[model samples]
Target: MVLRYVRRHFKPLLGIKGLWTFRHTPLAMYWAKLALKDMLVETVLKDENLPPDVTNAHWIAHVVSYAGYLAKIRYEGYDTNDDSKTHWVHFCKDLYRIGYCADNHLPIVPPLNVIQQKQEWREWIIKRVTGGYTMHALTQQLIAYDNDTQLRKGTEVEVLDKFSISRMRVGYVKEVIGHRVHVRYWDTDADDQDLSNSFWCHEQSDAINVVGWSKTVGHAISAPAGYDPAEIGNSSVIKKNPGVNIQVGMKLEAVDPLKLSAISAATVVKVLKHGYLMVHIDSAGHALTQTYRGVESDANHGNNRFCYHVTSPLIFPCGFCKENNIELQPPIEFKTDNFDWNEYFKATGAKPLPLKDLEKEVIDHGFTEGAKLEAVDVMEPNLICVATVKRVIGRLLRIGFDGWEDNYDQWADATSCDLFPIGWCQLMNYDLQPPHVENQEPGLKPVSPGVKRIKSKSGTASRSKRQSATSSSD
Candidate 1:
């Protein structure tokens, strides 16, 4: 009976191959039920014949796709996030309300909270698909920029003169780390080196213009030194390389950003806007078959997923490790010495991100392996510790905290502000922590200033001592 109903009602939608699959499938009843619900929602509740102004086809498609994806995942015995399920139920209720109102000739007015819920649903779906900011988010940022709000230190703004309210005076934002900004009018006769004449006001006060802002409002303004007025009108605010065309499910080799020494087989789980990607390292012991199932809580469950830009030097084409004679950490199933990349790709239906998209000019920061330097400990932000350059992959530097275990190592951009030249701490009058000696091998002296050492053996530190030392330094 279900098959007959589908043949008569959904033949055009499913076509011949789909009908044959449903007929032969054990889950025919389930598919038929889902089809019936979707049909009712589309034909009865949604009223697809409505004018384009009244109905958005793209939005409706996204809603339907989201519902279908969730239902399919649930049917496959995977747990989805509660918020997703709740939103779907709320959407169905909203559709029912609209249909009921139309049938009774009553006004269709949803409560403000219901309206807000729909907006939230829209945003959630976009985030899930895009993995980052959408056009709406970019627009909001532009609005904030145009309003001359969210001012930061070093911003140059135009302020209304206190003595003459009609006159607008250019000013430099001396400080804005706090809730208020300290401004010094450039038109004043006060000495350039003097901050005594600077005045403080709310950071978002209308009295500032953050340089380039006046150009947005059709006003002629003087550009500050090293400021380009043309840059203010450019819409490409997000820092993304051109021609990055990555998609979810594509396969590539990626360095474990945290474990910089290991490169593993990876899959693009999410393709975010502006060339960003959320990739899942397959060698982390999780099967690729379970990639989409329970992804929201993967981190808590010890899954190795990391976000990287498309042009990041850490990610490479499928044959990269083989060509470079580097060790490739394959998925758990293919952990043999004879692991085959071709077989893995065929089994998983994974394609490599095009090499053209990944190609970009590499910047050289001249950092070499085994070089000693000072680095800020990310975990203990206040502490600057002696560190060694462990690996230099393109513009990225793997920094190993000297005398510490490999687990405490970190990867940073070569030009990162977190790293400083040797002796920078002494120049700045900051107390620099020497390499921890407790974890070192017996008779191995602590790393001396300006002395380079080979990679040390993995060492361990007691949790109590580590915590105590970090706290005392703080």
Candidate 2:
């Protein structure tokens, strides 16, 4: 019944009501269409040269055309009084203007009772009969948006300030500029066929890149495929240069398990271990396993974390989560190998080394071979200092220096830097110290694995301590 009523009214308006059908006056309707097109084209071209406000007129004209069409339907149907025609035309015009306010991020103001009364009549006649008109529904939405009083008081400047970073261009340090893109407002004088005031876009010339709080670098920054750091330079400190070991901790600020469709914080975690580096994330005990260098772990280990080749840190807030809604905190500190390392060693019942014996082993493996263990200890402190500085520099440059394959290769092959790591340095080269492998009879015995190992100190230890202290003091 509702659909029938809508179709009954709309059918008449489609050239069946008061006028002769299109068959009788096809030429008249055809010429009217041509004139309308010409008018809009001229307006759009002229708009290109005008100020943003003036340009908005061209956009507004098109909106007005739509509104006017809606008004015409009512006018043609309720020809009973001049008052109805005036009311609809005025209501549609007001609706078009209210939309302008929304596009400019301005608060909408409710229309007067007169406009509301006209809109009510249009809605009852149409939706009750036909399903609903999208344009009519949108107009009603604008009314509701304007009714939010507190939002009306807000300004574009406040929104921009909260979301954008104010920075001066690299070359211009004397005068600071707000690095933001300002959306334009609507123009009222424009024809109904024109666009809205908020259509023009101009990039800021004086400001540097606008660093949105929500923006993040993707993982596409990894070096190209088949990249070999060892091949690029003579970073081989020994016959076999192993890569440095590293552990990572990930901490998510707050997350919801139910809302996969909602906004939340998440972090990526990586870990270092012997035999293979272990990668997994623990956020509030919610774990995600990660893979290292394209290697997969057994299913018994848990879910293998997928690695997206990372050149720059991947920004997860946009793709998987809501923009500007997530904030990541510093990682929860933990030793990656401790839990896994001790378990392997304990299970194997391997002989544990005394601190003195460990020191002697380090001295034997270290450069200036055969040096006294005490002398090696003295040199270890200096090596620790160097590693600390390197980590600090890496962090400052937004570069991860934790012995990733690419990072090590870059450090080893660089030709410009004189202070590059020596072949024996653990920064670019892996430790040569061999682990105690459990020998098993292949025919009948199960294979026993050795314990995971890690470097207690790296070149970045001092720098990390200082950074940790500085952050804590803050």
Candidate 3:
């Protein structure tokens, strides 16, 4: 009935014949369902005078799309008994009301006493349906909900401040907007008791933690409030403190940060705590810039330098690419095809970090090809879209967003927080952005998996020989 209604009323708007050409394609079908759902939410659900049966049919369609079951239902058709249908209608009506409130920027009304037992669950549903919470906030809320200790305004916590070293400062939660939390610091020196020094950060940031985190880590708290740190318990979320023993002047082959496809010789210019290193690409052919007090002239060039944790998958031992039969982008002076690691290191007086140190940081991601997941669009940070693991390279993953062109695909670390498990959006009550379909051309040919294509300097498509590695370290 919903499909019949859509065909009759929206056929001209959606070009039914043209859409049918790609009915077999998952991207096309998903795009169509998203279009239908948006139309119903923006138009059909807003009409209060619409008949119950008609509204119910449209609601059922919208629900199906939201749940991502449109593809199966379109072909298999859905059947429900009278009781199930009634329950779904009520649920859909609630979803519509929540959406309406969000659209109008109105506060949601509390439920009556009769339905108070499920009030908390309903509020979570409201947040999910409205799609207003950030990923961090949603995850925190889920954790809090399970633990029955939701963090709200006035919650005392410790915020990590990293300067020359790390210090935990006492602060109170002022406000939470999406993933950002405004923390008002307690000033001990101010006689007037000013609490105006506040800043915002992601709720799940490693820098932010429960009140007693500093004690567990043996870090001194910069608290002026004279509060008893001993009374507070450790944070629920454990901080990642992996040991990495990299030092300055260490040489490694790293993926060029600017041109991600190329691997080049790099030197660590600065070594910081917690396995982080500031590496400068060798002989990058970029202009040298002056640094503070002329301390490191070459390091001042922003394009030539990149920050990476010592255990990063992008950085590897000197001869890694050569041993794996992968192409390497050598320094400007060396021939790309004939670059020798031994001679290059000898002339530069560069020492490669021991393989033992690098091995400790290597993680087993357990990701396989063709697996479906929700991945954050790095270019568009707010969007968590449907994606597939197109390829995996040693601790690196090639993520291709669904319904998007290959040009938008990105390479990410296997342990990157940007990648989430399937159904994460649903579990968090966040709305997943539908795969974009308008950009896809008709009769598009799929590229062969055996070859990798890259755009050359002359703006032409060129194929690169892709070598498959048997081990994750390769």
Best by TM-score: 3
Candidate 2 lDDT tens digits, 250-279: 322222211111122333344322211122
lDDT for each candidate structure: 0.47, 0.21, 0.47
User: Which sections of candidate 3 miss by over 4 Å?
Assistant: 1-245, 255-263, 283-304, 324-326, 360-366, 402-409, 422-474
Against the hidden reference, what TM-scores do the models get?
A: 0.41, 0.16, 0.45
189-210, model 1: which lDDT tens digit per residue? Answer: 4445433234444443334445
Q: After superposition, how far is residue 54 of candidate 1 from its true place, in Å?
A: 90
- For residues 1-474, could you state the per-residue lDDT of candidate 3 as single tens digits? 222222233322121111222222222223332323222121122234233333321221223232222211110011323222211121111333214445565433322321344446445544444643111213233333432325687898887432111245787776554344556666533232222245445565444778766665454567765566663343445433366557788778886554444567777877654455667776444224322111223434344566565666667888887887766667666655678889877887777865445454555555667655666554333356667777777767778876555656667676555665444444445455544443334432222233444554423223221222111111
Candidate that would win on lDDT: 3
Against the hidden true structure, what lDDT does model 2 obtain?
0.21
Ranking by TM-score: 3, 1, 2
Off by over 4 Å in 2: 1-279, 288-304, 311-313, 316-474
Q: What is the TM-score of candidate 2?
A: 0.16
The count of backbone overlaps in candidate 1 is: 0
